[model samples]
Target: MKLWKRAAAAIKDQKSLLAVGFSRRASYRNTDLEAAIIKATSHDDSSVDYSNAQRVYKWIKASPLNLKTLVHALSSRVNHTRSWIVALKSLMLLHGVISCKVPSVVGEIRRLPFDLSDFSDGHSSLSRTWGFNIFVRAYFAFLNSYSSFTADQISRTRANLRSDKVDSVKQQLDRIQKLQSLLDLILQIRPIADNMKRALILEAMDCIVLESINIYGRICSGIIKILPAAGKTDAARSLKIVNKATSQGEDLAMYFEFCKGFGVSNARDTPQFVTIPMAEVEAMEKMVKSVEKDEQKQEEEVVEKAIVLLEKPRLQTIITDKWQTFEDDEYCFSEKAIQEYHQDPLPLVVSNQPVCYTMPDLITF
Candidate 1:
């Protein structure tokens, strides 16, 4: 049988795709692990952090891993990206080796505390907690906004962007300039220091908190569903809500511009649309306006019904109690949920998942 290098395993002359990670050194003769640790400590790369890798290496050499502290530190990717990555690499590699060396210790890691409470909604970082609920929610939003990730979708999206045949030379040049601006923005984003990842983490965490703490999302969804104005408001509201879907909307807009070579000069979050025939645009606009008018009338009726419902003491009490629950420190992803999770557990988490709490698509909203 042909000998192939093992994936994600520390090997003698193979590079790991992960951050500064290598297997435990079997012997001095087998220096694969040793070499990776040394490289990580001294150098920077697209994958590994110099210092974080070194610290991880130190822990590995000592044995009896500090799995709790190590895992906890992975949360520091908010500020220390490369360094955090190095630590992560080291943690995974050391854990792999340590687990095999002393299998009994593996169970102990499962008992370790996981901090998942980072509810930072694009404004500030929140504390960490140990839950995949938030992460699942963020994943849903990302998936919705990132519909262009696939080759098929990308092709279709690009096909949709058509420049007018009667466009003037000035328009063509302006389009090229806009395209170049998108490229520049991309360069800034590519540096990773542009806070792209941090923004995503914060935004993802924020989305969960925003949805959990408020009835706004539910209200919007309800309005779209129950109200007659839904058909009209759906477009505007969906655009607004779906606009918030991707944390990387700006980047995506730029990407679209890049791919289509079409001019996109609108705000980062707003979608850019290629102009269609004037008559088609007018017809669509008229339809949207008519729909909006119907939706407004429907919302008024809903408000009237809601006022009647609120007049009932029982319904008012229920609403008050529901709102009061937010005052408690005990929040989403309750202990009961965690216990249930143990029974029907998700797959073992690898990489960061953003470490998984900031799990955005839990139940697909």
Candidate 2:
């Protein structure tokens, strides 16, 4: 038979049987016809049946498959009954069918019993589904482990500091250091995965850093307040060591840089630097003052030299005056007065004839 003829006949048969509400007579006849088709198709031993089975599996996997459609397909041998459909059903059950706790048509399917051996074949779609599910489970398990470890560390630190006897500065510093180390460990793991899980791990690490910084700041403040009054040099030294160690840690260094860049300096009454016992601060101030004095002296010397230079005499150019004689027919002043005039108020009138001069020749020429 032609392929379209077979498909048309199958559709017609299915429609007629479905119209009858799958009555006992029609169901038995359809089941026998389905069995005959299965036997005949199997004789050829082609992969068409397997491919059809995969198509049915994909459809069922993509959405909630109804029992009626599954039963119809299984009875018609359009898809497999024992291998494909039954195995897919079992895999769905293993994926937490019940606690998915869906309260709808899907809930009925979840309530069905499933056998493990139905999907025992490794090549089955059932096994592939289960493998993906297992991966998800393992990923979550790792997340839980990281979260629990961080929470436990925080709880222990809180417990340690709760007792008055245990509030020693050394112990507090140790706790902060351990917390910093744990944060580093978390950050190291963030780059290992490429998915939502990695994103979640990074987010968790950020929270840990924030929480740890808050705790460390509080402890350091407490230590600072008590250490100065206790007058214990060893306690102060330990605090310094803690500060240095924290600065060396990568995350702590980043935090410090961030705070230094953006945090405002609070106005506290400047604590007496005298009590700090390190003379470096005082020496630095003294050195700055000395440098200022030297600079002022140099400026004063420059000004004094500039003033002396300003007081010195500046040279002036002198020009000798020459007298010229003119016979003034129309005269306003006497010739004696004109000759005795050391400076001329105006030029004397001279003859109007033009005069020219030529260069002198050399004696050899």
Candidate 3:
């Protein structure tokens, strides 16, 4: 049975290689992208192919339009494969692509082109590979959510940056909360049962660790922005976020510990926990109160000014109905004076002949 399986796999590999060799068309620049994708997601590869995955990411960076081809190729490979290994590998490759953070790529991948929500392994029975099937589904869910989350973050960042006003504390807090939710999702991507020690799963975990670090950084950045600018009303929410951030920090520390136990190398470099002083929160609240008091004082000053204006005597003018006359010279020139002053050059002509008038007699009834 093993021999037959090996022979079948070898034949499949040969056919895949031939297809890749012939796949160099207008859609791709060269055979490298196609070959890289194939090798990176190959079932025969005992471990994740980081090189090919990175290569694919570089191609995406060089030309984001290549995403269409990448999506099609990945979809075809993953959807047709019955092996959990290939599915996970393809997903990991896609995960690496998203890590590039290109605007176009992030925008385009806001929703995945393919579906894996109901993926089931065909190579093995339901009883044997159910764990893997679940793992793939969980991983897919995370990726889907992660893509949308990233796109939203990018859009909000661009909008805030373009605006004249500082980004609102509410918006910043919202972003942090989203990151927290994503972190929860990240925590749920653990390998199940016998697949716990698999190198490929560990690779995926490593990628997850990197993603966690990125999210943590963004959260820290958001907190920093919120702390100084937050008002009393916002300070309360900001405090909750701070507390949540601290809790999330601890959660991350524990998560790293989990990853370290699970053998993800990147977790070894997990940063220290985030801690915010209550003094800062108090300062923000006090500042908002002082600002409000100043505004009230200004309003009182304005009212006082208005009252003073009302108390002072107002100047009044009386209107008369009497008529007055002015000399013609002081006003308009008379019509006769105008005509005499500006005479016409042409002489007036008068008819010397006189005509007799005739009238009809009225009849009396």
Candidate 4:
């Protein structure tokens, strides 16, 4: 049954590819680009057609306008596909295109053109294909977030290049925290079942491992650079980040171990673990304490200043008369005069007739 479904999907993809090849709506070159995308993300997922995928990447890198065609073709193929193979391949192709780091592609693809968060595989029963479904969803989530991360990273890089100033410790730490978040998302792409050892699954897992290494390395480099400057920023915030990095290092270790056991070649060579020294953590703690103390001292000093200002004698004009004198002499008053004035209060005029003020009942234009 699986073989039959695979064959049908391949036939359908080939027919669609041929139809796109003959279509005159787009330029011949764009048609070819769309064809390449179709081929790269076809249902036959025994192995990824990286050649065709790279070709698409080259086309996009050459001219960013090709991205519109790419997005349309990739979205149509992925969104309409029921086969897990095609969905995964499409995601992998997108992942590669993003990896090319073409500024235009990165900026435009910050959010995916298609949604796969609720993707379900139709090639097999849900019970059997649940792992693939999870993998696809997880991969989609990571790619979506990672694309945004890449776009942001590129924007920041360009901004830094344009300016004479380097990124501050807070900026660096924020980037590291974001990379750590991406790592967490990538790590969630693990196979849910031991039987999910197919080449297609392994291929996707390999890519995940590679991305994890890249993100994890950047995170470690960032941590190293920012650790020395911890005192320069909010120490408590810095300390929280340091603790997360330490925990992420452990999670990454376990993630790679799982990858190696699950047959990812890249995981066999373990990346260097980031070890935040106890002394550094202690120093950060002390900085945090010192920061807290300084803030408390500032508050106390402000309070003391306020108290001293309050206690100090200040010249104040004293108005001995309780009554107020206005421009009208009749309104002038004194306490004793106020009592006499109230005793002989002015006469009140009471009108029994109701007087209504007319506001234009219906205003004319």
In the order shown, the candidates' Cα RMSDs to the true structure are: 32.2, 26.6, 15.9, 9.6
lDDT (Cα, tens digit) per residue for candidate 4, span 1-365: 76886788788988998888687795524888898999888888677888998899889999988988998898888878888888889898888889987787788778888999999988678888898899999999999999888888888888889886788877887888888899889889999876689898888888888888888888777776777777735678878877887788788889888889988888898877565677777888898888889889999999999998889677999878586556565545557668887899888878998988989858687
TM-score for every candidate vs. truth?
0.21, 0.24, 0.70, 0.78
Worst 10-residue stretch by lDDT in candidate 4? 324-333
**Which 10-residue window of candidate 2 scores lowest in summed lDDT?**
266-275
Report the number of the highest-lDDT candidate.
4
Compose the digit string of candidate 1's lDDT tens values, residues 1-365. Answer: 11231222233213432323444422222233344444442212134343545555455445544443344333332124222223223333432333343332343344222222232233123332112224422332322222212223234334556642343333323332333332233223111122333332332223322222122233223323322322443345433333332223344455444422322222223333322234433444566677778889999999999999889554433334344445244544578767888999889756743543564687875
lDDT of each: 0.36, 0.39, 0.78, 0.84
* Model 1 residue 3 lDDT score: 28
Give residue 215's lDDT in candidate 1 (0 to 100). Answer: 23
Instruction: State the local distance difference test value for candidate 3.
Output: 0.78
Candidate 1, run of 10 with poorest lDDT: 1-10
- Model 4 scores a TM of 0.78
Sort order, lDDT high to low: 4, 3, 2, 1
Decoy 1 TM-score against native: 0.21
TM-score of 2: 0.24
CA deviation > 4 Å runs, candidate 2: 1-166, 173-189, 192-199, 202-206, 229-240, 245-250, 253-365
